[model samples]
Target: MTRDTPHLWTEQKLDARYENLFGRAAGYLPENRAALDAWLDDFSRDVHERRARNAIVRHPSVADLARLIERDRIVRMYVSRMINEAHQRDCKNTVNDIPDLLDHLDCIVTSTPKYQGPTAFPMSALFTYLMMTTDGYAVFRDQGFNKALLGILREWCAHLDSKDSQEVLNQKNGWLSPAALADKKLNLQDFQINLQDPYGGFPSFNAFFHRELRKDKDVRPIDDPDDPRIIVSANDGKVVRIRRDIKRSDEFWAKGQRYSLYDMLDGSDLTDLFVGGDVFQSFLSGGDYHRWHAPVSGVVRSARVVEALMFTELEHTSGRDAGTESQVYGASVNTRGLVFIECPPPIGMVCVMPLGMTEISSVTLTVQPGDQVTKGQEMGYFSYGGSSMCLLFQKGAIEKFFPKDNTGDMEEGDPIKVNARIAQAVGDEA
Candidate 1:
């Protein structure tokens, strides 16, 4: 296929596509229909029960807490086993594609001769059912489960860091192959990438993804350094959503989506500071630059890595391709690296969050707490795969934003580059 362009399918097209995929499962495997329907019904009830409990004024009984703990323990074990099995298969069977393994769970369609088309992931009704189910929620919330997943990711990172991984990445069929790299439209001359052996360089795919640009090149902070009034885009991605005067906990703008400061901040003490803040959500495409840059010059107050579920796309219930559009309220659920930056004067504390998606959720932090960072400086990056980043500002810090051609629509926004001016600060207090 030619280099992929952004294909914005109309709502009718999306509906038709989903209906066809849903019909394939329903028609070819009629036996699974009843079970899928029954699971959806159960999930709806679980959601109702969850909301009912949230409305209850009294604290949960000790028995209820104990039962929840037991359930969590069981789910944690199951999730751990699932990760191990998947990792083993990928490493031993050379089955790099994960969606291909979903067939074993009887949750997705399988092919007789190793399928090669783009993986239609997170489209399975069973996958959606699993995410909404009580067990799935428990597995998601349990730190142990997340930690286990992280452990595997770190090990994989170690391997990728080795010379062997670099060799693989430089091979014809590797991630950096001409065919695969074509989609990115990468121009080596435009970037500060090392040309030591132009034809076969790039220490690894990780290095290529996080490659820095030349000092005299395209990306840089606006000329006015003394002005605290300017805020720049932290990464190269399309704006998905922007919200102002956010509540402590309320439904996200996306339909049927809900999130709270506690969940977004991983229940840190910093959560309260952002109860009534402004949030800007944007996501990277598969071929977009992967490194994260500092959005403002500030003191790093605190930086924490939060453990969360991977491949948990919130907008899946809306019958959209996972990771293709805004993930609605997924920032709260995906494993993320959080940084609280205390912007000088006019712009106060701001939060920069980099969330992981799919199997490439490993975050490598380049800076730590107490460090002073300048705008456009690297903060961190995802090892592989497209991910999302969020910017949370204190209420009123950003007086007004000129999101280029942004109309506040979820589908598309003006293409942004790191260090490019995106918003301006106000003189008034939030």
Candidate 2:
């Protein structure tokens, strides 16, 4: 049926996209298409009835279907999940949707079909899962999102202690050293020495205050499980934010832009590791795809053959401070042949990397020198998601990260919102 068009979305693509997503989501449903259809028909009628019955409930309406369906309990369960996932890709403001979604949860839950074996995802549980995925801080901006997110944290996490980080924060029981501090969004000052941080010998009151640590982490100095954030926002100091292409070596930082992409990573195409990036978070592992897949699929072209590499690592190795959006994509290396994730047509390669609490701490990749890879295969695992992957383009390849209407370039250290085009990959061959 008719769908709402986002400022960035095209009217023409909505039908096709929704249909395509429905098809893919349908895979998670039963093989019996008839049963699925029947469940949907009843689900829509139920939602309509609820609107008539009560106005305070929040649920998803199964209306606007291209075709009718008469689904079973199992079918209804899957449909609820599918609807929730579709909205996560692009949220909609249906005042009635939430209550309706929550209402059906009880009706469809039961120990029916199992995913692998014993662990079953029932309707109510799946509804909760979908709710968690979509109920992120919405309708907010930079600070608002931060405040709202932090509130959610307070609701779900424990209270933090100090935020004034002068030295390297101690690793807590299960929290990063620096996190919430970055969220304070405060400016830094000069002449203030944090006698704690041990960076390069040079010290000039690090312009970007708290650049070393963030306040978003759990500030469990001793062992406070109730700490909401690793680092507290109210008590933390400032951090320094360096742009992409940051280099410890003077030569590289001064003249990195001069050299072409090939020279940056120091390798060639023919290799086994095709893709590599900072392991901010993962869906397969821990919502990794949610952080990377959108930008990857948006502008990547079909002409170039591509492989996928997911790097898993601990948060401390990347030196990522809290409050700063974690990077999930970075400079991917290719030591062997020029085999890499090709640049999406016209939109070079869009990288979605969220480097966590560690940017540097001596980490190693569990991958060999050369290995072939598929688009979504794993290459190696790092301690944290702190590495980088480069979007490779052969000698005569085109690089694209931005769409014409939108300019979402992957310029070193920029946050990528969903549906934002990062780059484009288009060359002579493209």
Candidate 3:
């Protein structure tokens, strides 16, 4: 079927929501010659330079994409620095006094009283990056951080392969049907999504949305960060997987492309990520970070971290210590073990936790480093999403173990679910 008129997602449709977020963050911009005592003048001037620098364009290649992402890292750095500047501009201390500053900072991004939006297209990218960078591997691994551009890039990926084919070149890089959202009435089932594969037939919506929803766009989270049910843990005792990889230079960002960020670090050097001693208590949010959880209870025998897509977010737009702020997951305590399965839980662990979560719950590792657990047994949970778990086993494996267990609160350890309300997305209908 021919898409007569694809609803155009014009530049005007982007969100210019003012984040009334104010606080001091770390600095990541190239410093100017201005003296430290005269910080305001230095910060304002430097931000202009920073934005111009980030706006620099380069050829879109694997090597170049990696450099772009690494350069994009500065966005978080500058935002933190500038936000801190804003806090210092005013005489505010204590977490309780932050509300006014948040409002002040919101003005910087949106139609605030102090200023209007800058020339940056899609300002949300900056916010999205901040959120992504905040989460350590523990969270980022499972949440599709590396595969950030999947939704928007499906179409673009095809174009990259079909460059010489005139017919392919003539085809549209589909983003939306021109009138896809007329009157705000959308029948998701009626939405004809297709991944233009090299094949000659069209794919079903079930097959299309997952494969070709969007192509080659930067990672844009759904209306809510937790809407994807992609957290890395489950209610029943099972293992979960998280993965990370960057293409800045073709070498994997951290561990082999499939390695989890948490399993490789310790509390001493990475102490900032752990909350007291609770792994679940530790979370990463801010700067466009996102998460996904496992949909069913099963053992994660093997996993792979692929360098899926690359798109850059502009960080040099605003000043920090004023209207800009960013933070990574404050705590990542894996010694407590990010997720625990039953005795010998590493292989063939049966689980019964429901596949859905309405909130994030505190997860208690019922088993020790190598203890065993049964299906529906208390493993861990969150009052919301952005959290998930997985399990793993070797190849040629075949076994279905039933539970000698029942669902209940942890007793020997008394597992608990501490609900958290971390982020909110405006106008996210889902």
Which lDDT tens digits does candidate 2 get at residues 179-277? 312322221121122425442221221122222222354221211212211111111111112233322222321212212233333433322122321
The stretch of ten residues in a row with the least summed lDDT in candidate 2 is 228-237
**What TM-score does prediction 2 earn?**
0.23
TM-score, candidate 1, is: 0.65
Summarize candidate 1's per-residue lDDT along 1-430 as a digit string, tens digits.
1211223334354344343232222121112334444543443354345445663222222223333435676753644444443333221221122222222221111111011112212123333323333344446556654554445445445545555446444436544456544544454444554434632567664566566666686554453455668788888877756667777776543554344667788877888777677778777755567789898998999998886766443433444332233354667777788999998777888999997765453777888999999987889887754477889988767788777433433334566777777788888433
Candidate 1 differs from the real structure by a C-alpha RMSD in angstroms, to one decimal, of 13.5
Best by lDDT: 1
Candidate 3, residue 323: how far the Cα is off, in Å:
26
Off by over 4 Å in 2: 1-256, 260-263, 267-372, 384-389, 403-413, 417-421, 427-430
Local lDDT at 175 for model 3: 19
Question: Sort by TM-score, best first: what order?
Answer: 1, 3, 2
Distance from true position, residue 327, model 2, in Å? 13
lDDT comparing candidate 2 with the true structure: 0.25
Question: Please, what are the lDDT tens digits per residue for candidate 3 over residues 32-88?
Answer: 212211333333344445445663222233233244334566433433433343333
| RMSD, every candidate, angstroms | 13.5, 22.2, 22.6
- Report how far off residue 310 is in candidate 3 (Å): 21
